[model samples]
Target: MSDAMIKVALIGNPNTGKTSLFNHLTGLNQKVGNYPGITVDKKTGICKLSKTQKATILDLPGTYSLNASSADEKITIDTLNDATNEFSPDVAVVVTDVEQLKRNLLVFTQVKDLEIPTLLVINMADRMQSRGISLNIPQLEADLNTKIIVISSKLQTGIDDLKEAIISYTSLSTERCISAGKIENNTITHPELLTSLSAIELKKVQHRETIIRYQFINAALKKSYKIDRSKASDLQAKLDRIFTHKIFGYVIFGVLLLLIFQVIFEWSSVPMEFIDGAFGSLADWTKETLPEGMFTNLLAEGIIAGLGGIVIFIPQIAFLFLFIAILEESGYMSRVVFLMDKIMRRFGLSGKSVVPLISGAACAIPAIMATRNIESWKERLITILVTPFITCSARLPVYAILIALVIPSERVFWIFNWQGITLMALYIIGFAMALLSAYILHKTLKIESKSYFVVEMPKYKVPLFKNVAFTVIEKTKTFVFEAGKIILAISIILWVLASVGVNEKFDNADAIITESVSKNGFNEIQEVSLNNKVIRFKQSLADEASEAGKTITAQEINSAIAEKTPEFRQAVIDDEISALRLENSALGTIGKAIEPAIKPLGYDWKIGIALVSSFAAREVFIGTLATIYSVGSEGDDEEANTIKAKMESEVHASSGKKVFTFASGISLLLFYAFAMQCMSTLAIVKRETNGWKWPMVQLFGMTAIAYVAGLIAYQLLK
Candidate 1:
């Protein structure tokens, strides 16, 4: 066993720097996956202890007790209790904050009772020095019958010592640290009476353990931990007095939210532009280098560009998560939950729902999973159902591209980018919709489940750098993999649909277009006029080919046409050759079928096709439009502005008017803002609800709302 790879589980109460220790031990070598039968993330990494003996470190979901109540807590308990889980640790490391040592020990003691080899980590040792605090490490270690590693995850201090402790894991003991014998005996005898205890009574039991642990903690504090109470800053209390004020708290929160969105929009543009440029160059390189054909088109246009739309938003998502992690690490998020509980309760949501709502800004899948903390079934369900309404990172690509297309980039209020404001407004609208939907759900749902909100607002502490970095990286990775798979599959399917046309409908389109143009007196004009028309038609075909790529080919086009006109082989061949000349060449046939329906929305066939194809995911819409426009243009510039110009300048066949009017652009923006078009979201809702009913309702409801809203915008603006 000593020579074998040891499994170590790092567990602790929330906000206790457990993740910081895990990151310091494992660095970037980590993998995140879902716990079996649940969406709660399970994070594991490999820690190299020696040449032959390695340790597989598991960062278990943070919990206050081994008594499993929430889904997250259940994972922690089950993994430790069941050896068959394979995740069960040979040694358990309990990370306890030096400041909150007493409260943290409750979990530590519970782990010891499991009789696993254990080591106690007293993190934030740097803070003890700053505040003139000291610790008798040997005495504390002796008292706990375990090894103690006092370290600062922030400064990378005591990390070597901690690693050394891990190597000497066999020397650690699993004996009971403190005397809980009498308390356990008393509780067991009066089990029935304890079972009937109130919420406050349950808390008293928690406090009793805290007090018992405090005795030893205080003794250790006198010997080694020291703090000058008079000199310590009261900034946290001062800030809390204002930030957590009954009336002003909500106001401050609102203001803070506005600022966050403003910053996210303003700060993320540079990195986004760089990523956009990099991917565009990569696409061009692939197209030129890969020998022009079907596979080249698929690689360059379908896969690369499609994936770029998602990857470009990584910076923004990382930043958003960075702020969230810092807030949680500093214990500010818990205070926010405490402050919002009353307001959330009135809306039939728990304070815990705030975390999910905030997290949903980055993505909804995890947000739905985050609802496991909500005690009441009704509240949890409502939270899950409405969370998708929060504009997620997947929506960012759509919003960024659309805002660039529709909204003017002039400054407003001498501070905000008009485009940024529009993006922020869309986010706000999503949140508003979520709340309204939750309110309606509260009334409609008849499930009776007792609701409770009890949160411990730990004292503010400086967040550890290691923890913040680990959180950002881990969350970003999850975002990429989860959303990436869906986007890839959808991109392939969409390319096929746009590239291949069925029957004589597409086969004879070129002849029909040519005859119509000739009847309009184009045949009476000079050869230059005829050639110009042919070139324009060819350019349109090239655009479609470029947009659709190799997903559809001339062979598939001929096969589809053959099925329609087996007897008229020569006519079919001529029509097929002509149509293939226009369609296979580029953006020729995209809007032919749906033009009439979309004409009322002020969009031509190209815009119509872009609108429909984008329904799979919002971000893909931008890439789809880019591909369509790029197919028609002569030079290679995949800039959004270039695409917008091509769209605006193109004349409509029905009216001879410019295709992209101000009203049309605005209508498109509004439609995307309101539409529940993301297939990934629909699939997730189905998975979360475990049925088709809710997702179907959501899809239809959102689409209907989008149609009404879009129609109104177009009519009024026009």
Candidate 2:
């Protein structure tokens, strides 16, 4: 390849520590993005070989073969074969762990057959010492006709040797040294089999292909490869006796899930509270420091509040990803898949669907994309359709807030956070719903396709902490940025609608309210005006008391004035004017129109407005409520809290019962949990499915479920 940067690609089977080795070689300089015309990620980084010669290292997605059965494997195969794709690497490094040598060699052999300069990396050499394993490196090198490098990503040893091997990539051979053997010994003896073998050999001879490939493998195995029968551990046999047993496996799996949920809920609380308090204090400080105006209100009450609603959940999300990454990294995830295969297969899903199901706990968008690996169209479609039913991190915020509001904090067993346990229960219910829906879809959908389940069970190793941390940070960053952007935009729009009014809508509220009151001939007018005067007078006195106390006094007076006087009669009418303006805004008009439909759900026109605005995202529900409450307040703590407390206590006019009762909260929570309220998720589904059909199905299906469930919940609880 001239003096231009040599391209090197790392390819291997899944769970082979390919990613870990890439991280060790490239460090934090890697960039991740989707492959061309596909959602499967393409990760690339630069490995500086010397001051003058830097190599571009592309970390291709993990795959088992060149057979191109799935999108991920197709990408690897297509990129490697196409010279114009620019992903064609000059040198290919095939990573294999020492313990899983036979299985690992399958891919290694495939890569060599492609005739690229290849290097075999025997990773986890430290494990070899611990497990009393041995490898005849020189013999393996002769057998494979490729240079070999031994390394341990976890212990950070042999990395320099690996680097040296990469730097000297020109010395590696492109010759294949092995051939796939006949299926049975009888086949080798058959005349037809001999004829087929001769034909294949004749073609290879004509093409000048390496005949030594088969000869070398046979000779090398005779000299080098040996199984240490006495040293082999029985850990797998012992663990499998219990873990994969028909009865115990299912029980252990269920119990493991229960413990994970309990731990996720309990462990995330401390950091969540700290984040909540920090954001609250920041909002309070911003309001106090900034001059009183729309900008100040927007910053303190809209953007910061909305962003906080998302950020506070990061700890919980990070913890969930941490556990998941560890499970995946240590190869325990495949065991779960193996254990669940029979049950999943009965529901028309392959064992591979287990990965997507587990990933759905974090978000449905990636989970839906992950289904790309499933071989059967029917199983993949069912996975995509039902994954959203699993509780995602987005639903966590809604659950946490509502559960805290309605579920008492009393311990379930003197240890569990009862609120936390309830939240966990909601997640379980979501999972159960997902499986049930998948089963239904499986029975109903009639598409025919081949189905197969094949996965490599890599040697178990202690999860590398750096890998876990990197995953947590990357995933949490994506969650915050994607959800944060949408929530922030919607928050600003809601703030604008609530803050300003058109024409004389803002100017005429006071006059309109006063005229209406006077015409009604209500003797309460005098009493109301007297009360307004007392509240304003007290506010003015408080403002003059100290510099630190002026804002509170003004707020209290404004609240009393808004409450006691009709809008028209109120003097110093900024608060009433803002409320009047909001009532005439576009959002306000929409809310009024939808109010009748939602009245049965225990919401007023004001709450109806908030709900409509929050359809952009669930966390926005909290921000919308905060904005609505802030706008209606007289700007005093006592007035603000009084109004909110009154809101919490007040009954719906149509129902003549408390509006925010436990029933209403639970109904809202259920609706938020199941509904496909995220536009981003829909967009991603559209991208992944390459059509509108699947996203449409997901949208309508989820909304229908949410509606029915919400209706039943509210009716029963009410």
Candidate 3:
């Protein structure tokens, strides 16, 4: 049989369990992407109806009604209004909550008026019995002129019934509930006096249309629907009183956030270490097993090491999204939004800004896009402008590495890990800075618009494991692929920049190393024969230690060998040689040119190069360091070498002191915490605001803040 496909659109009002049904139908088969020429997310999933037919279920954005108010709502209008649209559905599934059927039915009635073959899915059927609500399924179906399928999206009951109805779509009705004549020319002729209609006028029309639809719902539900007042819970009210309490709510939110950060640090460590070791081993094996050549070095040092830097952070990134997903699924996030509104309002932001700000922890691009729901132009802009200041996962790698270097592993107060505390503090700092900046921008930016904030307080439910798992998997994959591509490209370019030379100085590095080694009273063994020379030299160090009546531990002997033996010392010479070569390379010259600019921040030319490369992505700062350090790490045991160890052992070229000192680490941490280093975020800001002006100000303004903050941190600490 030839495969036939049907496009089935899933539409519903917000908080109606539309997404839960979508997740159930699609499972792991769903695809998430943006609609063409717009930033609004598009979710589509394929479900096998039979051997001969398939359904491409598109989950359109959730909206309250047909009257479009925001960018997300517009996507629904566009998809349903245009018959020629490739995504047009053969049958539209209107999902509604059984408990809130009155409000949910408003959307169904509006969609039915579009003359589309429609199925009404009354979700949460499990609650109907508990809530003592009963539907006259036959009477409602006959009156509404559509088949009604009652299902519990949570319990996965009655789904097969819905699927069977979907397969029999041709038998369903395309009869508009309200006549087309009633809404001709986007104007509704009603008892309430109104002239020609605009969007605002249509919203008023939509409001009256709600009342009209409820009249029909009321008649249909008269004998069909009944609610038991006794079945309701005071638990919801009791919990809301405490969770939304003025003093206690803030404390609970703070503690929960802190615990989340602590869990991220503690839980992610074992997996992160494993990933780091695996990638390091792979790169080591590549260098050792593959034949010596430019391509081999590029694969091992540039590609593998760069990839290592990214995948190693997957653990932390996954944990961050996991906690966030849990909060969202459990309905606690709504309370958080409500709790934050009063505080957010003082900063000229709507209460809805909490969603984007909280989501910004994952990535700024989506977070900024999430701001479209804010009805106020000024508030939305302010939210977008400051959302990046929230600590995103992109900064996790940089923060993780620097925090580990500067912060000790000891426990604080005999319970909290010092490193974990610092990480939590960094997260808090990001949030505080975001709010503070919003406050400042609120006072400065003059643009204002009428504001409205409305968020549904979803009833608390144990989060579904399937939904939470899917969310973590999808988000982690997105972070890896999206950030990995950039890191891979930059790593290759950086490799070439550090590999190639500007003059004969790099070409004669071998001779220069030999001359320097011999003049320093060390035996002159060429790079090739240095291994044999080092073996013999180690025995001499052992004899010298014995003659001096000094006990040399195995590690001490190895250190002695590393310092004196020609093979080990030759690696040192090579490292210095590579450093010089890099100093003269294209990337090195750029770093050198900017060295003076970053000098006060406790950064040298090498750090300057990393900073310049990192502007493409903040996460790549670690990858950049990995690529640069890999060049000089030749002959070191792959098992013992880590980026942190390499940095700890690095000697400053001018000061001969350790790089990444306490002062420098603090400065670097501060810089990454505040820098607007993501090009994608800047582009998104441009697209979102529909202009370059806002993004430019964001870029420079953020960069200046980062610079000043870095300067102050370094100066005070150094």
TM-score to true structure, per model:
0.58, 0.62, 0.69
Summarize candidate 1's per-residue lDDT along 71-99 as a digit string, tens digits.
88778777776768879898889999887
- Score each candidate by Cα lDDT: 0.70, 0.70, 0.82
Lowest lDDT sum, 10 consecutive residues, model 2, at 182-191
Give the poorly placed runs of model 2, Cα more than 4 Å off. Answer: 1-233, 270-274, 502-506, 510-581, 603-615, 632-658
Model 1 RMSD in Å is 15.8
Worst 10 residues of 3 by lDDT: 186-195
Output the lDDT of residue 61, model 3.
Answer: 94
* Over 4 Å off, model 3: 1-233, 521-564
Query: Which window of ten consecutive residues has the lowest lDDT sum in model 1?
Result: 521-530
| Model 3 agreement with the true structure over 573-690: per-residue lDDT tens digits | 7776887787788878888899999999999888888898888989898888888878746745544456665666666776566789899999999888888999999999999999
Error of 3 at 445 (Å): 1.6
Ranking by lDDT: 3, 2, 1
Top-down TM-score ranking: 3, 2, 1
